[model samples]
Target: MITSISTQIQLAARPVGWPRPNDFATVQIELGELAPGQIRVVNEFISVDPYMRGRMSAAKSYSAPFGLGETMTGGAIGRVVESASDAFPVGSVVLHQFGWRDVVQEDAAGFKVVPEIPGAPLSLYLGILGMTGLTGYVGLTAVANMVPGDTVFISGAAGAVGTAAGQIARLLGAGRVIGSAGTDEKVALLTEKYGYDAAFNYKSGPVREQLAAAAPEGIDVFFDNVGGEHLEAALDVFNPGGRAALCGAIAGYNSTERKVGPDNMVNMITRGLSLKGFTLGSYLDLAPEFNEHMTAWFTAGKIAYDETVVDGIGNAVDALLSMMQGANTGKMVVRTAVMADVIR
Candidate 1:
C-alpha cells in the first residue's frame, strides 16, 4: 500500500485589490492507498499566470472563481509514480488541472499522458508548448485576422504570452513588429532577441507618444495584453481597417476602483477598425492546428523563449504576485523538489 502526503496551497480568502500572502494558506494532507482506476503524480512545474488574479476574486467572470479553502487549480505537469489504471502506467508524464500541489492522487480520467520532447524541459509544456503559446497563436490568426505585411504591435511584450506573441507575429510574416514593456531592459530584449522590429518602455513616457514614435506609418494589427492606456494608444495609432485582439487587461486586474475606458471612442467608428475580446476556452478548437505549426517552428529552432523559475510550491503565491507586478521577464513557474534529475 502506497501512502503519501501532499503539500497544497489553498485560497484562504478572496483578495480585495492585489493578493497578499495571507490570502493563501499552505497545508499538508495525507493520502490513502490509490483506488482502482486512480493514479498518483508528483508535480514538476506549476504555472502562475496573470489571468489567475481574476480567479482569486469572488466576482463573476468567464472562468468560475476558485472555491475558498480548496486547492488552487490551474495547469500542472508531472510524472505518475503509482497507478492502478492500465492506461496510465508508472513513470508516465501527464498534464492536469490539479495545480499548486506538489503531489496529486486522482482518477485516471482527470489526467492526460503526454510524450516527452527530446532536448526540451517538461516545463515548456506549461509555457510555450501549452496554453501560453496557443493564446498568442489563436489571437493573431483567428481573432485578429493578422495578414502578411501587417504592422503588428503587442503590449506587455516581456511577459510570457507577450513574448510568445512577438515571436509568433514575426514568423507569421508581419512586415514590422513593435512591442511595449515596463522597463528599458525588457524593451531591449524584445527588439534584440524576440525579433521585434521596434520596442518601447511604456513607463518612460505617455503610451500614445511612444507608440506613435515606434510606428510612424501606423499599425494594422494590435495584440493587447495591457488595457487602459495601451488600448488607447493602439486605437490612436491604428490605420484604417485595422484589427485588434483584446487578450488581457492586467493593468486593471488589481484595481480597487473602476477603470476608465479609452477616451478615443470615435476611432473605432471613423477608422473602420475591428476589435474582438476572447478567452482561450472559446477557441480551443484551434489547438490541433496550433500544435502542428508551433511544433514545426519550435523543432526547427525558430522559437526562442525565457522562463523565470521559482524553486518550490510554498513560494507559488510570491511568484504569482511578482509576475503580476512585471518582475518576471518571461513565463513565471513554480518548480518542485520532484523536478530534480527529471529533465536533461
Candidate 2:
C-alpha cells in the first residue's frame, strides 16, 4: 500500500450568499493502489478559484455542476511517486484537475507534464507559467484584441488572473493600465508593484466613479472579473469600439439568486462596445505560445507575479472560500506536506 494521506473537501450543503461551515466537509480518504497506465500523484499545491462556486450549484452552465455529497473539484499540482506507465517517471511534476485531494491515482493520459525551470520556482508553473497566465494572454490578445496605445482597465486587479492580465497588457505595449481592486492595499499593489498606471478601490464607492477617476478619458479595453455593477460601470465609461473581456464574476459567485442584467448594457450598442466572455478552456491551443512569452517576460523581469499560498491541503476548502470572498492578495493556493508524511 502507498499509505498516502488524502484529505478531501466535500460538499456538505449548497451555500446561498457565502459558503459557511455547513457547506464544506474535510475528510480523509485512502488512495487506491496504483496499476498499469496509472500514476500515483502526491499533490503539492491546489488552486482555489471563484468559478468553483458556480460548479457547486445545481444551475446549468458550460461545465457540469458539482453534485451533492461529492468531493469538490479544482486544479492541482502534484509529483509522480509511483508510475505504472513507460511514458511517466517516478519524479515527474504534473498539473491536473484532482481538486483538493492530497494524493491521487490516475492514468497518465490527461495530465500536463511540467517542464523543469532552471532559475524559477516550480510552484510558479502553477501560476504565471500556468493556466491563469494563458487565460490572461488569450483574453487580452484574442478576446479583447488589445493593441498598442490602447488604454486598458481590469477589475479584480489584485487577484491571480488580473495580475497577469495587467502585466501582459503592459508587455503588449499598452498605453496605460488601470485597475480596480476590493481594498486599498490591493489597489496600491496594482500601481506600486504590478506597474499599473492607475488603480482604485472599488469597495470605496461606485465602480463607475472609481473607474472614471482612474481613466478620465475613457477605457479602451476592460478585463472584467467582478461583473454586475462593474460590468455596468465599464459599459458606461468605455470608449467607442472598446473591448471587454468577460472573465469570472467573483462578485456574484456567492449569491444564490439570479442577478439582474446590468442597466448600462444598452450602452454596448450605442457605444459600439464589445463584451466577450471566455473561459481558459476555450483557448487551449495558445498555452504553448503563452508559456514562451511568459517565461521570457519573467526572465527579463519585465513582468512580476504574486501569490497567496495557504499552508496545508486540509485548508483547501477554507482557502477556496476565502478566495471567493476576496481574502487572498493574489493567486490563492493551498500547499500540502502530505507527500512527505506519506513517504515517512
Best by TM-score: 1
**Model 1, residue pairs in steric clash:** none
lDDT of 2 by residue, 1-344 (tens): 24465668888887877878788888887767777799888888888888888887788987998878888877888888889887779888888887777777878886778876667766667777787888889999999999999999999989989998999999999998999998999998998999999998988998878788878889999998888888888888899999999998887787768887788778888989898999887788998889889878887878787889888876777788788879988788888765556543
Total colliding residue pairs, candidate 2: 1
TM-score of candidate 2 against the unseen true structure: 0.95
Write down the lDDT of every candidate, Cα atoms only: 0.92, 0.84
Q: Considering summed lDDT, which 10 consecutive residues are worst modelled in model 2?
A: 335-344
Off by over 4 Å in 1: 1-3, 341-344
Candidate 2: segments with Cα more than 4 A from true spot? 340-344
Q: Could you tell me how far off, in angstroms, the CA of residue 297 lies in candidate 1 after the best superposition? A: 0.6
